[model samples]
Target: MTASLSWQKSTYSQEQGDCVELAVIGGAVLLRESDNPAVVLRTSRANLADFLQVIRQGPAKNSPPGR
Candidate 1:
């Protein structure tokens, strides 16, 4: 059987201008905007998990905040 791909909004999304959508396909991860679905960024599952871990770890005081 083949795995299907679907997109879902991020739970971290708030009323602010920030929003994101994620898709899982063939053991990989894909991310895109809630408004613009045409553009997508692809990454490995491990890489995506690591990226999320870093984001969850929060930013340093001297570091520029992510958008």
Candidate 2:
């Protein structure tokens, strides 16, 4: 049987529509939004890490702190 994913919202999200969740199950990372849990995005943890790294090094750096 497939194991259920334990999804958690992003710390940066508020109680409204701007909610994102992530989980690691086996060899893949799962992503979803609180506004719609019926759909999911899956990818490798390495890929996710790389994407985050790029975001960190990109224009997101211009975002206000404490985000």
Candidate 3:
């Protein structure tokens, strides 16, 4: 199934291993680690966008006393 999809690595990735690759198929987005190509994660574009947004925002302000 992954053979047909075009996987893309992040520009920030400098090494051959330990990098994340992404591919879009139909209405879903696919992701996998270069070192572990056999394991893949599928999610919608909207959900991926939300996850990226949260990552960009850094840690949340409201957390337990001892984080």
Clash number by candidate, in order? 0, 0, 0
Residues 1-67 of candidate 2: C-alpha lDDT, one tens digit per residue: 1237778889898777568899888899888878778788999999999999987886665778765
Sort every candidate by TM-score, greatest first.
3, 2, 1
- lDDT tens digits by residue: candidate 1, 1-67: 1125567778878866658988887877888887776778989999988988998988877887673
Runs in model 3 with CA error above 4 Å?
Answer: 65-67
- Candidate numbers sorted by lDDT from highest down: 3, 2, 1
Instruction: Tell me how far the alpha carbon of residue 7 in candidate 1 is from the true structure, in angstroms, after superposition.
Output: 0.9
TM-score of each: 0.68, 0.73, 0.87
TM-score of 2: 0.73
Better of 1 and 3 by lDDT: 3
Model 1 residue 63 lDDT? 83
Which residue pairs show collisions in model 1?
none
* Model 3 lDDT, full chain set: 0.92
- Candidate 3 residue-wise lDDT, 1-67, digit = tens: 9988999998889875589999999999999998899999999999999999988997779876665
Identify the superior model by TM-score, candidate 1 or candidate 2. Answer: 2
Against the correct fold, how does model 3 do in TM-score? 0.87
| TM match of model 1 to true structure | 0.68
Evaluate model 2: give its lDDT: 0.81
